[model samples]
Target: MENCPFCKIIERRLPADIIYENDRILVFKDINPAAPVHFLIVPKQHIPTLSDCHEGHTAILGEMMAVVPRIADMQKIGVVGSTPETRTGGYRVIINAGPDGRQEVYHLHVHMIGGPRPWKDNK
Candidate 1:
């Protein structure tokens, strides 16, 4: 954990553009963003990848899921309208598992991606 960038952020040893923080979790802007609105939600505890999670991590896992929506809303990325008639803008929550999943960070974290012009224009 000593050399972990996130750990350093948590310890206030490293600078992060923090968006949200609580006793159990920390949400911050991703240095290398894939979208205009991109942030990462990570547990304070160090757990390398989703595959590393076990029964003991249930509470933290649930907490992470529970906070995702709130964080999305905070970032102005939550579904604006949701009804049988129409559904407006929303966000994507991604958890890259391991090497095959393109997870650059070893620590388990969720990437929140959204914005009006989130996707790049190929044309």
Candidate 2:
């Protein structure tokens, strides 16, 4: 984990466009964004991937999930209504587990992406 990019950012050894930081989590803009508003929510503690998570990581993981909506709100992303009649803009949170998931970074992190649907160029 010593050479991990996210760890370096947390240690202040590297630079990142950090948007938010808490004792357990760090949110920053993704250098290679897939959406207009793309950011990564990473746990300060390195936990290789979601598959590697254990009961000990529950609290931090829960906290991570709890903050996503607020972060989306901060970015002005509306709520994702369940009904078509109530359609509203919102964000998507993703966790890529392995190579098949296209997880370039080994550190466990959630990708928060908002702005438009169908992800214009990502398709």
> What TM-score should be assigned to candidate 2?
0.90
CA shift of 72, model 1, Å? 1.4
- Pick the TM-score winner: 1
Q: In candidate 2, residue 109 scores what lDDT?
A: 97
List pairs with backbone clashes in candidate 2.
none
- After superposition, the stretches of candidate 1 with alpha carbons farther than 4 Å from their true spots are 118-123
Question: Model 2 off-target regions past 4 Å?
Answer: 80-84, 118-123
Candidate whose lDDT is highest: 2
Task: Give lDDT tens digits, candidate 1, residues 24-80.
Answer: 999999998878888999999999899999999999999998998898888788886
Q: Write model 2 residue lDDT over 36-98, tens digit each, in one string.
A: 899999999999999999999999999999999889888888586789989788788999999
* Clash list (residue pairs), candidate 1: none
lDDT of 2 at 14: 92
